[model samples]
Target: MYRERPAGFARAVLWTSTTAAGAAPTRVLPDGCLDLLWSSRGGLLVAGPDRTAYLSGGGPAERWVGLRLPPGTGPAVFGVPAVELRDRRVPLGDLWPARDVARLAERAEAVPAAVLAEVAVARLRAAGGPDPLGARVAAALSAGAGVAATAAETGLDPRALHRRCRHLFGYGPKTLARILRMRRALALARADTPLAEVAARCGFADQAHLTRDVRDLAGVPPTALLPPRPV
Candidate 1:
């Protein structure tokens, strides 16, 4: 089964799958652009604007790779978990370079599941400890906690926090905080709260602030993205 939720910014989740689906993978680009790429259970290999291929796992082994992505001209795929792929905008070939999978197959198997799991755990630990900046930032944003207060709570200097955020999340601390705040607003919007109420509760300056942030992150107006309240 695969379920994806937009977690503010470009982050998302692809649930566990049992088979390798030859489908195009969908990703939110660095500039917040969204696109689909060819992927399988083995890993998610995608080429960036720089023409570099990146692979991340869709199964037990969460391995990632950075190399030249292969090209393919096919329909863009979406929605399926493992076995099937659906086409969307942009032909698959225009987006990806042709890859000789057989020749590069060995590199794909470089990291075992156990090793990957360990690495993930270790990385999580490090992220929470030495790299706790992202965690601290995420926590603060989730709780609507202020950046200054979060820095104090995490025992990190504000400047240090900023540095860590840039290194880990690709954005500065304030931007991440705003993104988190916007994420909360999206949740509240989906819950059918009034725009003003969502703005206030999410720490936005006002409804306009809420609208701007929501539109920036979700690619749609707040009203359009949010579902109607249950009658």
Candidate 2:
């Protein structure tokens, strides 16, 4: 199950899961988000923004819970450039001091998913408020704006936007654009939209362009994403 964070951190999300028996590796596609996860057994870990699908391990007894923060928010909460954590899962202890992480874990592990968001909210408030422009930047880019257009809409020049995106999202605006576009495409594809129309609606130059973006960001073709399950 999953729910959006209900408090000050509007872009945050939380979810809980019980792994299924004999499950294949889960294909977690990139959406430019970062996850803070705790297992019933594995304790705490951070899942970074992935360029392509991350194949995660699975088993029946592996219960877990997580909070996901939007692209620019993790840095304020985690105190590191998003680029430094890209495509990796590191122990929370590795980022925070062991003793601090132990203390935080006591709080995190004791309550429901809501408390996890509260912890991040408190940390984020202490670091100053959430990034003022990150949402507008993500919205503009996800809506098919070019990097330059997104910069203009967000009042950032191209280089400035690229630098901020790299720090906050672990990639430049162009890559963020592609990832979000594939996300858009996948949503439409899952709804039974024909690939040609989806490509057109999502602003891909052609079906081939859409196919390449899917391959680049999801590690699959459009047909694979069209079905209810992973290929």
Candidate 3:
């Protein structure tokens, strides 16, 4: 089971998940977000923006809690470029000094469940705020705007947009747009929409286009992504 609620910080989601019985290995599809996770059993892990799926083994009764930071918010809070974390998960000690990481780990282990969110909120306040234009850029891409159009709307030229996207979303504007579109398609598909209609609604050229995008971004075919439906 998985559930998400507001993280009480700008541009973040607080989520928790428990593995189901006898589940096989699962892969997390990229949705252009970064995560800070705390496990009672696994400690702290920073999930970078994944260009492709992230795989992990699991079974029933494993509890996982996390705070997912939206694009552009991570650089300030994590003190690193978003690009550095692409397609990777790193221990906090790798990015910060050992003492700092140790102190953070101690704090996280104390509460078991809520400490990660507390750490995220404290970091948000300490960082002053998230990227001012982050929301606008994400909105434009999510709405299926082209990179050049997003650049024009955001008052940044194409080259500048590419640079900012790398720092903010861990990729270029085009790739971010692709990721967002695929996500849109996935949401629609999950609602039982036909692939042809899903493609059209999400700005794909056709069902075939949608299939290719899902394959490219998620490393799986479209059928493989849809969950089993009840009769």
Candidate 4:
């Protein structure tokens, strides 16, 4: 089972999931976000922004609660550049002082969602909130803007934009744009829209283009990720 709600702090998401013992691994598609996680068995860990789908480890049944921080927001909360943590999951203890992580872990174990939200709020407040540039770049790209256009909108030259994007998102703007586009296409697909229509609406050149991008990012074809259409 999995559920999520807005964190109400910095556009983050509070989520929880439980896997049955011996269940197949779950595929987690990238969405340009980082997660602070506490599992019933693993204590506290941080999931970095992923460039591709991450397959969860299959193990004994376990419960997980996480705070999913939006792109650019994580550096403020985690005190680390997004690129350093990209495509990796590290224990919170490795990043913070062990003693502090221990106390935080205790609170998280007692009340996972609330504790994670509290920690995020405190950290973001101390850092003066996420960089405003992140929101602008993400909005532009998610709206189907090209990288150069997005850079122009954000008032940054190409190189400067790429540098800032590496610090804010785990990758450059072009990669982020592709990831966001794939997510948009998937949303339309989930609404039962025709594949060709979804491709057209989400800015793909064609259904084949959509299929290739989805497979590259999500590790599966669109049909495998969505429910079968009725006859």
Candidate 5:
């Protein structure tokens, strides 16, 4: 069974099985975004930025895991019983053991799903509100605006900004900046804008920079990912 929780900024979907013994293994792939996954029974095996998955019926305790991807890899495989998860911005991996997640999933059957969603939203709000440095950095990156200037605006030393970002966001400031720029470029490319224009508008140094970033994060060239526009 699948349960959805409202995260406010980003929604979360939870999956669980009634008969844990009958649960099949699952595979989760990269979806070019960041995710925080928790397992109740088992642990998730993450194979680098490109591949990370869970083994269903593996766990029953609450273990939280966070993953951030920079793109550029095909779907990862999870070895177990047959299960597949797919999404453009979010991919699913093998269903492994997760005690906490399983408990939450089971709880959904008792309480209203919306109530659990509200709880998730509250948690996300608490975590996000307590941290300002990461948000400031993320905002600047998402805008494709000045990094140095934004760091200055936050009243943090350039190096300090880097340190805080890595601590709070689990990635370097520069890497986040590149991901944000790449996302902006993707938006433009999807709009049918020319490649050079997309690169320029998204603050990439050039088309090659855009290409490299896309390849690194999405495991495919920008052209390959962008759908052809109707003439």
Candidate 6:
């Protein structure tokens, strides 16, 4: 089973998942976000932003908890540039002191979700909150703005904007825009909108363009990503 709720700080999400024995692997599609994870078996870890889908494995029945930090808020909470952790999962100790992380891991063994939220809220406060630029850039791109237009709207030249995005989102603005657009297309499809209309509404050149883009990022076609229709 899987469920999620807003974390009440920094636009993050608190999610939990539990798998039965021999459960199938989960395909986690890219969405330009980072996660702070706690496992019944693995303790505390961090999940970095991915350029493509990540296939998460399952084994014996176990519980997992995570705080999903929105794009651009990760560096503030994790104390490193997003690019440094891209496409990787590492022990929280690798970034913070082992002694401190170990103590927190012990607490997480009892109430994992609360520990994740406490760590994020504290770090974010110490850092004076997430940078406003992240929200602005993400909003413009999600609203169908082109990369050049987003750059102008954010008041940065193309080169400067790209550099900032790399540090903040672990990729350039163009890649982030592509990921966000793919997410938008999938959401529209889930509403039972026709694929062609989804493609047009999401800024794709056509339905074919949408298919190729989704395949490149998700390693599957749009139809495969969507849930099955009713009988």
Against the true structure, whose lDDT is highest? Answer: 6
Worst 10 residues of 4 by lDDT: 222-231
Error of 5 at 110 (Å): 7.5
**Candidate 4 lDDT for residue 80:** 90
Off by over 4 Å in 6: none
lDDT per model vs. reference: 0.44, 0.81, 0.83, 0.92, 0.49, 0.93
lDDT for each residue of candidate 4 in 1-231, tens digit (9 for 90 to 100): 999999887788999999999889999999999899999999999999999999995889999999999877888888998999999999998888999999999988789999889988998899998999999999999999999899899999999999999999889999999999999899989998999999999899999999999999999998899977688
Model 5 alpha-carbon drift over 4 Å, by segment: 1-33, 36-102, 109-116, 124-128
TM-scores of all candidate predictions against the true structure: 0.52, 0.90, 0.92, 0.97, 0.57, 0.98
Q: Rank the candidates by TM-score, best first.
A: 6, 4, 3, 2, 5, 1
- Tell me the tens digit of each residue's lDDT in model 5 across 67-114: 332221112112211112222122222343466445555554455334
Q: Looking at model 5, report the run of 10 residues with the lowest lDDT sum.
A: 73-82
User: What's the CA error at residue 30 for candidate 4, in Å?
Assistant: 0.4
Q: Local error of candidate 6 at 141, Å? A: 0.6
Per-residue lDDT of 1-231 in model 6, one digit per residue for the tens? 889999998789999998777888888999889899998878999999999999886678778899999989999999998999999999999999999999999999999999999999999999999888998998999899989999889899999999999888999999999999999999999999999999999989999999999999999999999998889
Counted clashes in each candidate structure: 12, 0, 0, 0, 42, 0
For model 3, residues 108-211, the per-residue Cα lDDT tens digits are: 76664577777767777887877777778999999889998999999999999999888988999898898888888999999999999999888888899899
- Sort order, lDDT high to low: 6, 4, 3, 2, 5, 1
Q: Which pairs clash inside model 3?
A: none
Show the lowest summed lDDT stretch of 10 residues, model 2.
1-10
Q: Report the Cα lDDT for residue 36, model 4.
A: 94
